[model samples]
Target: MTTDIAVPKSAQSLEPFVAAGVFEPIDIHAAGSLARLITGLEPEIILGAALAMRAVREGHVCVLVDDAYADIDLSDNAKKLPWPTPEKWRSVLTASPAVRVVEPSETVVVAPGEALVPLVFDGVRIYLDRYYDYELKLADFLLDRSGSERINVDESEIEKTLDEIYGKLTGEIDYQREAVRRALTGRLTVIAGGPGTGKTFTINRLLKASRILDGGRPRAIALAAPTGKAAARMTEALSDGEIKATTLHRLLNITPQHPARFNADNPLPFDLVVVDEASMVQLALMTQLFTALSPNASVVLVGDPSQLASVEAGAVLGDIVTATTPDPDSGSVNVALADCTVTLKRNHRFSAESGIAELSQLVDAGETEAVLSCLRAGHDDVVWIDPSNPDDTARVEQETIAAATQVVNAARNGNAEEALEKSIEHNVVCATRYGKFGVHYWTDKIQNELLNTILDCGADRPWYAGRPIMITHNDYLNNLFNGDTGLVVSQSNSAQGLDELKVIFAQDGELRRFNSSQLGEHTTWWASTIHKTQGSEFDRVVVCLPEPPARVLARELLYTGITRARAHVSVVASEAALRMAIETPALRASGLVGHLRQSE
Candidate 1:
């Protein structure tokens, strides 16, 4: 449908952008279905090894156990707990929740329409959602793939002024220039790069050339992000036109009432679909997008594969990069077909001399010791609290409290300079929710003592009129996203108080109103999770590194967490916790690796 594409290299660096993680190490499965719901714990579910294993392995009902049990620990339980024979395990699959001996019963009050015998029975936690495992779905999609047909574009048919784009964005680097060129030419291209490499800037230039690049075709360009805030950001970036911007889910109208119904042969309304944070797009979602897209419409996948993959299954962005990337080691596993990837090598967010910049480089290379030393070098980033003793958990908690208190005070105070420094100069981050120094603790401390919130959102969080509030979920229609920040101007609630409260978002000096239920999860508390805050940036960031009692995040998390700061960063953690986070290795879905190995 599109023209000659000199297969662009997938990654700039020779080093692998992704590492393979195993789903079902033993390649064995039955019929495949994509789009599974991998939600958090269902209030509290205590399932056992047999049931938990069945739910995850065979039943396609994934569980959300404590991260500490990264492994299900079925074997350990079998040895210690005098459970039934291993051969008889499958019986638990269909056993009723009420069946005491065979079923591992609980006295939980089931919610309407849910079969919740116990949210957590004997300490096994799981969620029950009828979603498909997209990892398996991706495998199915690849298995059905024919071969890649190299797209050839006639230069004679192309316009000559593509270089004019480079002139527009001042100081546009060679890598960016190359990426924009590829995006302009190819029908489907991946602008793969890391933080501050100017993926957004390149996309802006491309959006400007939508007409020139598409050969005078009516520009029905649509922009989408995996999350709401991202989509809102895209909407803002895209200049006024017939262009439509929305979250991928909202674009498909996939709400509770209207489930996604995409026909593979049917073409969509738009001529081009540009997706930001494409790495986060799950397999099932991608499949639907491809199936629903107009046969001739182009797709541009933009994101850094080095960051986290989709929360669901399959690293579609990385898989595509590897398949197209030229690796001597990429034999059958990393097939080269559509060379449609561009990786930005420069760091735009941080300068060379800055500690954060140096930290990012070291973390990317998986250099744990170097990162530790650099952080320990210590700057005036008073937020970087290093613990002297890992054994004393309370001390770390106190340190976190002190630092957060300082940040909250600086940010929420009426002083203009102090507020500027807090909002533009710094952000606070934590590894997980449950720890003493985690996001929950910081949010609570800020709320109970710091902000003096005036109204509750009718959701989980309270609304402070002037405090900077970051939207945690994508409510695209309402112009909210994972990173978009704004202030609460006023609260609107009906007299009965039964209805959802309407919180007006003061965005760019304009009031965009939304109901509290619609606002979803948000944090005025400033501190947030590392995972939630990805794809966003601040001038300065403070990382609250508490020793997680459970699963320690990998080094990439730290890399991403640190990179969020534009000017400075302070990490508060005991040496031991910090080391654990940095040393943890990342594993990609192997099913994707298997699919990518095929030659186009």
Candidate 2:
């Protein structure tokens, strides 16, 4: 006779078991034998395991295991078997550290949360604490691997390389020369600076110096960035076909179906790797990149730390820089950090007298009065558009449209081709929200109302000449990635009577046709949110600061948008909105620095 056992197969089925004092979701994979495992275990151990599982799953580095049990129940009829009281659970977790029945190797080690409990199982793989463990492991891995092969190059040698690449150092201190010298001395180097700080110049010199130090034996170098536009920019700066830049995803062989083709077991094949726009890289992604790197390979990270961080769950570059001791009271230098990090301060994009440069500094420092003064000043580099009615969103929209119209008339001069070229040169960045005062509103106003080009196809969202479109997804075959923007050169009806668009992306340099159907799911109008403009720049920038400042109007966002402008910046904002934006700084939660400090 066979006895039928009711197994919980679905999430709903597991719900009843959970309420009845069963394993948490963290152990859901082992749900089949959970009851059998619990049969002989003490009530306190069972309860403690559940709490420990939850904490680890929640990405906590460590938590007191004996803390209050909020989710589980200990009432008289809560379970059929005897359940441990909250006090008893705490007592079990709070006990002195003791060994479990399992061997040290077999035990899945966990910290304070469960105190002495090993939380072990015979065949179960011990899971690392999601982000915290990754952070700790990465920190130790980098420290162990870095400076293992410090290529010693004289200061004069570095100066010679810089002079060859770039004419001469402008400032009293040759920051570019110093950065190259630092890069050669460490396997892991971070080149951090704000906009127009000659980061590209420093990187080129570093590449040249690395070759010199290595006996000019053509070192294998790979350049990568978090996004396609950033990669394209890096490639453009290097102007080397043999050493072309690629997106991190493509470089790692990441696809929709898999995390990566390259990992710890199969590391990337390269002698030196340079990651541009490092600030946009997430911590998890950074960890993956590091894991895939060969032990002795040199790595360089370049970006502006003050720019908007990754949209995901990490402020990686900021965390890494902050981990280093800025000023030691004991006057002892943090050689590990100092040797591996270079902060570039000289601005090459703008002159010392430029208003855009002055405004960025003020915004970065969160100085409301200084920023306001800079914006209000009659400077040729800045065009301030203060709406008459601060409370009226409609008025702000109209005022912005008027400013955009003026820009169009000035740049276009009634030439169709010139209009298309000018549109790409200038970008209208909106505040981080989707409403009447955002990208959608401005895209419609600019495309439909302001510059009404005749539509070639009859569709819901018809394509017209000079319509700016941004790729929202990566298309490896087309060599396009998210944040890549283009203008519609032409449009027509396909054989299937579907609307087709031919877009020419600036990144491509040459005109490569893309069908509208191919872009339907991946394209968005060019009036972008501040986040999308992180790794891009334009000749002119028109920033639409929402009339009633939203919470998302972070100082970094405003500063990033402003800095995107190379020549001019037109701001459409009320005084109140501008002040709020300047005052509010973006805050991201991360613990990489804490881990780094603990390791130190």
Candidate 3:
């Protein structure tokens, strides 16, 4: 199952070609070191530039606007890079959304892309500007010593208390017990764990401990998550009526009218706040959440450290949980303890023998080739469909269709004992929305070609009747949240019905109906972006890797996607494509991530 292919000419060096502080692999992006890798590939130049800029920003680098004349200045007054003489370069650079070349000042606070676009085009040497200001500020805030060591978490006390109150939870595992203990006593607590590790149950046990510590009086514990689906899950997990849950944005009501106004003067409604999936909450949002907390309030952040960081800024959850050595060199203060952090190592979600569980470990090890080899050998739960090539549009399309068809046919035939279960439990996923095996292409294929069971009204969106569907977006009114699976039993069939899909969702033991618009675009077959499925888990998963943009595939995305499945996982891709995604290391700017271990 393990074989090494010929090393690419451009990939001999382990160091990534960082342009304007953004990390990009040479073999895929600009062909290792030589800019000539883009000889005949002119169409991708503009797109490549944009991707480069985005990667840098996502890694927490500031690509601020500067004057074209002072682009290279290291001081406060910036200097711009020299303009390229090539006519093609000038034309494409001007058209990019990142650049504002027509402006008089030339560097008047433009988008981050503007600064990086020109550098990417010309193949100029990009100097690293370490944002020491923000790094120190973040470090100091996390390592605040306001009675941090004073807090005492007695494990025996917590366990005894839990058993006294929650007899059902008396036999909790060691990892869950430790997490609950930390959450009970630590002011700022983090429970870092993977899927099936009983995060919800652990949080519930903490809720029980909170009531016990508060002398049987209900504690005002507010729960919030980054997304609506996660928020809903947070609320549903706790049976206690005292706990109120919502999305972070809704809880803060952060409108333009109310700025970052989370001070002692403007106190929050609850005594404690627990945010789940804290990984997805950006630094900007986290800043507001952190500032809003009263000094007396307890904060609990729960997420997986190995998953992706926020789309906006700082790796808050991981940073807080990481063991940060006061980097005298980087102005990173040494912190002995980070508000009591614990990682649940045991996995109760996917069994140790399950293919998904194995795949997860392989991905964590960055062994893409091993995962591919294991996937190629089909099992009852896991199926691998090979394509002609990663770049062949026709082959990718056919493979996606074939895999989806197999799942559907299995469901209809009831051939496999768990076929119907798999239909509802299985989902198809991809990295991006663009290309042959993307969400739209596969969504259309499943609706019109594969199942072809529902009747379409032919409106703005063809609202089908009695068809299996998934909501792509959140609709609060209909209680139809994204990732909520349901059957489109009926619709208006009138003017009001245009662009709407009538879905009946199973809530609590009853069937509830909602006549909502295409809040979640229909795909008779199910598939979601890796980001969308972060906090969720499934029985089986199909990962479709089309010839996506090089920057889109990485260790974190592939690893996170593989970990979503509980029982089995099937990845549809060519061996070459698999190798590229696996072998290519997505390097993080050394300054962005703290080298702190998760358990620290």
Candidate 4:
């Protein structure tokens, strides 16, 4: 299987240099299915090419075959082949028509598929085939709107109508009016900002202005979010429940028949679609959403770019914002894209002079020292607890329990369910990771110590009365969705020796019973990670940070967790953790912007 190639003796230096740096090798056995897709490649290069392609699909730039034997699994017939050194990888990969080395180094190989444009990189790396297809498809879907006819509306008339609609709102109407104007003039609109920046308010006005422009006839508008909780919030924000919102999945009709019932062949039946909390929308989901839209339909994506990206993969909103953002010096950008983007700046949730607003600005700007200074200065809305110290460690747990004191006391006294529900709605505890200092530790402590309730059904999963659980996946039959919260009300053992539990969802008061064995342990969680708390708001938030800043403590995580609090934020972490959270930005490898620019 070894390729016949000649190498100069002078070039036989193994200094251990990689082309695009080192990347963690993927589990090749788990990716065996992809191996079948690769055809007409040398036996020696087949494993390497498949592993590299799988790595790219998993969000890595390249795959490294560092160790010849350990990095890959060899069959009985293949083990006889020579070890795949860097020189060997280069020569074999170069000879194969299925894969090629982008760099001179022999360590990296990428599959060049039909969807990708000519592979080129100065500082930017090629997205390979799988990621390249996603990026290229999404870019084409978004850019197709440029050729679609825009709404016919007079600028002065629309501006006057926008002013009238926004005048009823609290904040200044200048930004809102401008955003509405751009939205009406463009087929694709993106509204980016942080919390309290009036994105929802602006969207409401945009709908009103669009109706006004259409001679007072309401356009067919559909509202959606990435999660049910976010959709519920969006529904509550606009028109006081007049405009309903649904999850993007439900809107797309994603089912066993296909990933989406609606697609390019069968477009969505709406003239305008507004997606709120767009930050939580992953690249694949966004692509599905866009592909189903009618070419002439107007789309508005509203999200906070400073918040954490979607938990799965891809940064749709962040990439769009970065690509469309204009240069400060020359104000140069794609005119069509610039016209489609709007940044809301005014804060309505927090007062202009509030410390929470100041802290948020600092976090957004990556001013680590300034944030620490504010925390040290004792900001009224920002509470900092150093868990590294013994006293503060206890304080961190105490404060977390104190945040839910009302709910815990109500449960203990057997008080009215209404009051307990009200108390639970106002408080939340968030952790960066699910390890020692994360949600599992805090949830177990709260259930064991505070509630003093436990149920063992011969399974590792624990259940108890008054246990707070968040749904981790959408259950279509039960009408439960990811991000939905619930409380266990009752539990019992059936004659079949099965454990059953009754729970009440926050979305609805109906108590439902289900067997413990019916669902996986991961379907529910007692406490939530910070990423789970995205697009959610609570009056008070207790952020539990591990003593040592882990890789999960990124600037966006801290910002998203803190912004979830409306009244106050209590951060439980060491000083070093805060510094790490403030300094480190979340890194996501995506080529969305590259393809987006190519389309323009």
Task: Provide backbone clash counts, one per model.
Answer: 27, 2, 12, 0
Best by lDDT: 2
- lDDT by residue (1-600, candidate 4, tens digit) is 122222222211211111112222232332233334444445445445334454444434334444333323345544554446666665665665544234321122234553332222212233344444455577776666644546554777766776677654455447767777777766788888888988988888877776777786667889999998788778767873445888999999996557799999999998888999998888878989998998778888999988988876578888888777654664544556656788989898888667778888898899988898887877788888776567876775666666455554443343336533644454545655466658777776655555432333323445544456667767777766778766555433567675344555544233345444444333334357888888778777777766543556778888888888888877777788888888888756665655555444
Q: State which candidate has the highest TM-score.
A: 4
| Model 2 TM-score, 2 decimals | 0.73
Taking all chains together, the TM-score of candidate 1 against the true structure is 0.67
Off by over 4 Å in 3: 1-137, 145-159, 162-173, 239-244, 256-264, 321-335, 376-380, 389-424, 450-461, 466-487, 491-501, 504-514, 517-525, 585-600
Write down the lDDT that model 1 would get: 0.54
List the RMSD of every prediction in angstroms: 13.9, 8.9, 12.2, 8.1
TM-score: model 4 vs. ground truth: 0.78
lDDT tens digits, residue span 111-137, model 1: 468543322222222322222224434
Instruction: Write down the lDDT of every candidate, Cα atoms only.
Output: 0.54, 0.66, 0.55, 0.64
The better-scoring model by TM-score among 3 and 4 is 4
Q: At residue 505, what lDDT does model 4 achieve?
A: 55
lDDT of 4 at 508: 28
Ranking by TM-score: 4, 2, 1, 3
Residue 217 CA error for candidate 1 (Å)? 6.9
lDDT tens digits, residues 1-600, model 3? 011223234433312222222233322343333233333323324333433344345554332222111212132321122233345555665454433333221112224563432332212212122232233333444445223622445656776786675554635546676666656655667788777677777888888788887778977778898876677667766776656567787677754456644544686767778999987776557756766776656777888876777665556666555454354455553344543667777777665556666666676677877877667655555556565544544544555455555544543332332332344466667776657666766676666654344233343454444345666665654655556666554333476654334455554334566654534454443556777677666666767676533566776677777777766776776666666667654433322234232112
